[model samples]
Target: MFTPSYHDGVIQHLITDVSEDDFNVAVGGQVEIIGWLYQYYNTEPKDRAFKKKKYLESDIPAVTQLFTPDWIVKYMVENSLGRYWIDVLQAKEDPRSSREIAEDFGWQYFMPEAEQSDQISVQTNADSLSQADIEDVTLIDAAMGSGHILIYAFEVFMQIYEREGYSRRDAAKLIVQKNIYGLDIDTRAFQLAYFSLMMKARGANRRFLTLDIRPNVFDVPESGELTSADFQELLQSEDEAKQLDYLLDQFRYGNEYGSLIQLDKSVDWSMITRISNQELDEGQLSLSSIVLTESQDKLREICAVGKILSRQFTIGAMNPPYMGSGKMDSILGKYVKKHFPNSKSDLFAVFMERLRSLTDTNGYYAMITQHAWMFLSSFEKLRSVLKADTLINMAHLGTRAFEEIGGEVVQSTTFVFKHQTIANYIGTYERLVNFDSQQKKEQAYLAAVKNTDVDYLYRTNQANFAKIPGMPIAYWASANLIHDFEVGTRMDELVDAKVGLQTGDNSKFLRIWYEVDNKKISFRSVNLSESVKSQKKWFPCNKGGAYRKWFGNYDYVINWKNDGHEIKNFNWPNGKQRSVVRNPSYYFREAITWSDITSGSFSLRYREPGSIHDHKGMSAFSKDHELLIMILAILNTPVGDHIFKILNPTVSLEVGNFKSFPVIKNKTIEDKSFNISRKLVQYCKEDWNTFETSWDFTSHPLLTHIADDNLSHCRSPVG
Candidate 1:
């Protein structure tokens, strides 16, 4: 028999140092140690696959399996499984009594208010349920990873089992057999998850060490040569093919039911062992020989694997892996596109869709995932679906939420939702933002858990999200702002907003005026309405510059020699254009432009008619100059900035972000805004004209004084 006491090199050091007793209490830390080890090993694999534009099959689990912190796991379980019991208790509580009374009666293990009301339908007049009913509830973690969720759930199940008067040993065995279930794609992750749950059970009842008990954690079986050959042989024989067909149908059921395969509830261990022993001598692979176990021990493992197959869980909790569509392998990318067409932009979004399939009716699921799905336009359909569900609670844990993940790697949000969709569900949303360091983030999280009064933490309703165009779950948007989204018209209708031209090679096609010798070529920045060119090699280009409003950022020029024909026609040896030209009509058209990358705030400046715009800046154009000025004024205002931030939570703002913002066009307001913008533009124009850059000037006033020295011709103003 192969003992369960085996450690891979990745976690050998940590596993060897920890005794069984230490491992039980420190399971959370052990999970973290393994998570870091996995991350360390896959760093190179991730980089290699990214460089090669392929996903390394070997590292899929390693790349995705993150050790969800104990607190997050607890929050998910408490809100999900704990809420299920609370729902039963609430339904049984007196209609006139407060929820606090239900908690006081030990009917509710976790606070009801902490989760969404849609999870449980409460009736004060309903019949009371016994403790045995609580133990009957089942739970699973779809992406179980190191089984932290299941391990913690085991603790919760033990509490329920004990409360029902079951012995510790019996409760431990029952919890593994009936309550906890898990599935992970990675075999290594499945092993850790299975071991973690076993350890958890052993802690509850040390007698568990003597029994041939197995935790209901399973992995997708790798198709090997032996299994393939066996299947082929079975298909060739009519009698064997019938058995194969039954098994295949059961496998399909297993997938639909939550198990990776149809697990045999009853196993003839003695016969299985005999067959295994026979197969090994014949140089064939068998389950018993593969695991190197015999008798009831191997049968228990087999039975445990089946327990999760074709089973529905009452609760699901996971911190699903994060991978953007750009990083995904073509196979997974296509699968996501086919199944979850709306949220296929990111792998995390796809997992959000996948999570919906893992729970039973009225089952609750809780996850901490990227907050982008809550607002991005690509996930608009996803939001529409999720909003209909009973969103129990949301904690918007924006950037720097994870300590081990250095810097502001992911802006995260943790939420709990029930499987059922209730029309009148009210969910609580808590905002936790502006944490500069990891310590601050941790402190804020602790305070939120304690339900303490933290200044940054505030609450909102789930219904408020529906008013927004994308149904953005903007928990922080005030009631007034929500109303604005409902009433105002989107800006795309009022202006021609778009990204500018792409000079495929900036180094070859563009230059600062000082970088090249001055000679009349084909470039000039003059009124394009009338044909004009400066007698210089470089013509002005609007490549985005510093944060100044109204005007400026005209320091660049593209070599438009031969009227841009040579630059436009340039191509590489592969027959791909070395230079790209877009929006030819928009070029040299007077417009308002802004840099795509901003310092958390937006600044828009005017680009004159003679300038060619570059991709670094996006532009909004209109023949109605006054209207464009009015739009510019609105964008610079506090309201515009607020809307932009809500539409795009990230620092990077694209043209789509601009289009999403609502335009409040009141003629009276537009007239005044236009006047302010016109004045600002003129002031900026004078500032530009004051310098030697003014093309109309023969020579700089200061230089004129030094060259002439004619006291009479000192009409030049110099102090």
Candidate 2:
């Protein structure tokens, strides 16, 4: 009897001694490992029963590496393979009969088997097909891991066959041999495939095995039996080497590199006792050697068979391995560049090429792969090539195909491409096709637009309009209004006179005062005396009135003190001492407001009302100041608003670091907001001999018209 132990919620085998009965029980599924507890105990059964009991008492980790849950497998199988099975069954029945049956069942009828096979073959070949014809079909997964897809395909085929009058037994064998094929780099996976197929075949007649295993299964035939050599000899001399090379290459790479190397590295070579000479003689090669060579040779033969099959069946589907482009090192990158030059040529690209090579004209191929190929700039050229050559039908799968298998985070997309067709059916063809195509040229004509005016002359066009086609439009801007204004005049050139003054860290130098004794205040050019009766109410202040001091005798001519020690100073227009009165207590009732007139002050002061200096005696000529004020007012008019809105759509008056500007808005030339003020300043600085006469404010028709229009519009809305 076989006994098992449980540890950490896993079942393990307990018996140290092994026998043929135990092996048979495990392989035959007589004693199954039903859950996590079963697997742990079954794998580690040799310890004392109590020790095993203690381990089993421990809690299981939240996650464990286990086979995929059956329900998920069922869902994926039904959605993908289920639909495929129906197509195959419909193809086998009479066309009319199938159509009638499909109408009743609400399913699509499949084509005749011969036609279906021929179409699949044609679709795999790239030369004779266009992008449209093969878009609907795809190849099945060729190298599915764990036989997940294969098993699912089998189940689907079985359902279809049952509906078509075949018993589960017959259908099982047929589906294994014809509908599904699988390959894996692991020996264990290969073993699983064989076992799984055997389980499916259980209900069939024993004779069914002979037929199911005949075509591809290789075993030493009777002494005079024919071999691969016989088949090679039958082909034309010209084709023989090519076929042999293909076979040899497959053998060298497919199984040798894929499975043998893996096994040798994993298993220990040193092991036990030999049987009798006869028994040894019967074995010929060691189990390892036989397995290594046979598996390798089998893969080569499979590739050769695939080439032959391509001539017979065209449509192909696969969920190829997903690896990021970053993983492609120099060697693989160079190889892809050399051989698959016309193709996109990544890992997925190689699969696509292989599938295409196997198909005939009008064949179809489908795959679920990484979605990065769609919009990535690196793949843009590749997308262009595909757009020109194949019709692609695509749907994005938002996440990794197998959620539970912790691998890379990948977004997937399903692509269906037809080998050859006359018309394109996919929606993305326009985007994928290169701009150099005729279609793009036509679209360009429709989207081209032209605009010209005095202030601005330019053309506008959409970059991708050719792929989409439409008529071009025209836009016009007003002629140069600024043509009359001098362009290069600097600020000094525009003003008759200018002055500069330093405020000397204005925040520390400026005086701030607030009134507490009177409801009203006044300013005058006079000095206050300590002897005044109201002297107690006045305070020499600092920093927005937070600090104060009593006056005293200190620089008495330009500065004075109300008390015995504190000093107070007065500000003069030009930093020069020129005063008249030492005391005017009544007139010193309020604080004086000072101003700084550095460069651009007059222009800024003219535009902003509260920016003027009250005590500065030097003033602009009456005519010049009026002109400056008028220009400033004109800038705020509706006409100016309209012109700026059209020319500088993206500009905001708020000041900060400038970024995120629209590309188009940066191109316009007439966006300067202070142009009018600068022009008025230029008019003011003219020496009658070198410059034109400054026009009287009454003679400027454009400014007057704008002012009049604004007034009329403003009053029009008044009640």
Candidate 3:
């Protein structure tokens, strides 16, 4: 049972190098240090998985491990578990705002409901809740990685027990037994969570650890060889034996999907819950061999997970893993695609749905997840089911909110979700994105809560989201801007916009115009027939370039000889067509174009009559050239910038980003935009022509001003 190597290396390292400093905290005593340590410990594996460009099923936990910040955990729990108790208190005629009650009860992060007059028809979700007695109240962190949320929740449970006049000792045990439940995919995390919880209990009561207490926390196990036949001897009843299949089925991908696994509703776990903890009889214990005992242990553990999963909790506080569908392993990708279609874009959105379902309809669930779900078109279906009024409050914590994650990619929003008392609920939203660092954002949030006019704070009816094009949670969008969609015509209707074609191998069929013979490029060909007649191998292609308006970025030329014979037929080793030749007929058409993506600002430029648009060089075509110019002018204005910001604020501006762009029609060029656009196009073209790279370059503007005879006066008009 003893290994000298373990004692010498592991024991010696800890005894010499580790001490109380590793575990001790200055405030929030007995804090979940395990979560932080786990993150650090997992650095090597996380880096390894990321370096590989793909994740194995076993690496899912390491790859997606996010040690939720302490403040975020508190916010999630306060708004969810804390709000549930406050709702009951308010319903019982406490006559205090939720924030007031929460602060008095030691929950500072809880935001109060907006004050509404009695004239409003909306009702609070409190009326729908079954007021489970204090002991019956339950909370679960389904994806409780290192149990940070659960540890904070423990303190809240202790507070509730004290208010109800229970002894600290009794409350500690009961809290572990009935109040909090957790599940994680990683066993290392589960072990750390277990030790942390035990230490927490021991801190409350010295004798707590001495008792044979097992908190309702379990690491989802790999269902290796978990056949029904294996449990045949362990389970006495025929029905109980058959029920093993359901439990086993739920854990088929346990290594890949932890608490995200939904238990089967068909299985009745009442008897399983009762007999799951049965002690061995004296006769059986003496007679049983190792195999029998192991089987019994496996059955009990499986039943415990099934029982916890099947129960609907009063509250859910979680910081689930974050991974996109593209990065997900095969098993998980297939599971989420079939099971969570609406949220299949990312794992966090999937958990948002899963956790809400695990909660009672009247209960609350709060989480900190990628803010993309709030506005991205991919998650519009997710927002549909969770109606506007379901929102309680949100802290839109955009990028740089994590200590380790320093980029603008991992943006986040933490919020509470529960049905409101009324139809049109006014929810508070704090836009803490402008600030950097976790501490600064937390400070800003506190400041916003204290004073509503903190610039970033806003109180608005969430029902207004439904009036928008795709139900974006644009809490900061002005009322007039939102209403404009009602009277506006979407860009799809006004202009014929397309994403354009893609050459699978840009290197093979593309060349900088000057890189090849000038005579081989068909710069003046207006149509495919004209280009073929010219006997040119290359034609100008409108590839995306720098942000500029009107007549520039005449970048590269594509090999369209014989109607793009090479690009059109480009195939992969798997016999799949690789080159995406979209809108072939629209090739060589005079259209307005723009870079598909930009840093912040947007601009549209004119495409010459003879060019094919690149995939990134998106184009909009119209038979009426004046209408096209008018739209181009409108797009270059501040109005187009505002629309892009409202619709999608991410770095990549997609083709579909403008499909919902509203355009108000005006004929006769009443705004004189048509003429201004024409003049600007000419001015830009002249400026462009003066540059050496331009195909129309005659001479530099500086050269036109000076002549051999007029060296003294230098009076050319261009001067």
Question: Whole-model lDDT, candidate 1?
Answer: 0.66
What is candidate 3's lDDT per residue for 62-160, written digit by digit as tens? 988888888888888888888888767766667777767887897777777777667552334446443547788899998888788888888899998
Ranking by TM-score: 3, 1, 2
Q: Write the per-residue lDDT of candidate 2 for residues 617-636, one digit (tens) a residue.
A: 11121225443343343333
lDDT values for all models = 0.66, 0.34, 0.80
What is the overall TM-score of model 2 with all chains considered together? 0.38
Taking all chains together, each candidate's TM-score versus the true structure is: 0.78, 0.38, 0.90
Model 1 Cα lDDT, one tens digit per residue, 1-719: 12354565424655677555434354445555555555565667556655645555564665665566556667678778777666665465534333464344343324345333643345322354323275578887777877778877877777667766898888889999888878877766778788777777777788887788767678754322222123342133454444433433333322122232333343333433333343334567778544543322333333344434445677878888777777666656665677678777876777676676667777788898988887777788898877766787776777766766665547888888888766555566556657765467555665664563555555566777777766778777888888877788888888787777686888888887546665543344544333234434457788887777888776777876545766778889898888768776777778888887665577888777777777887888888888888888888877777888888776556777777778766889888999998898888876765666544335444554464567446565777
Best by TM-score: 3
| Sort by lDDT, top down from the best | 3, 1, 2
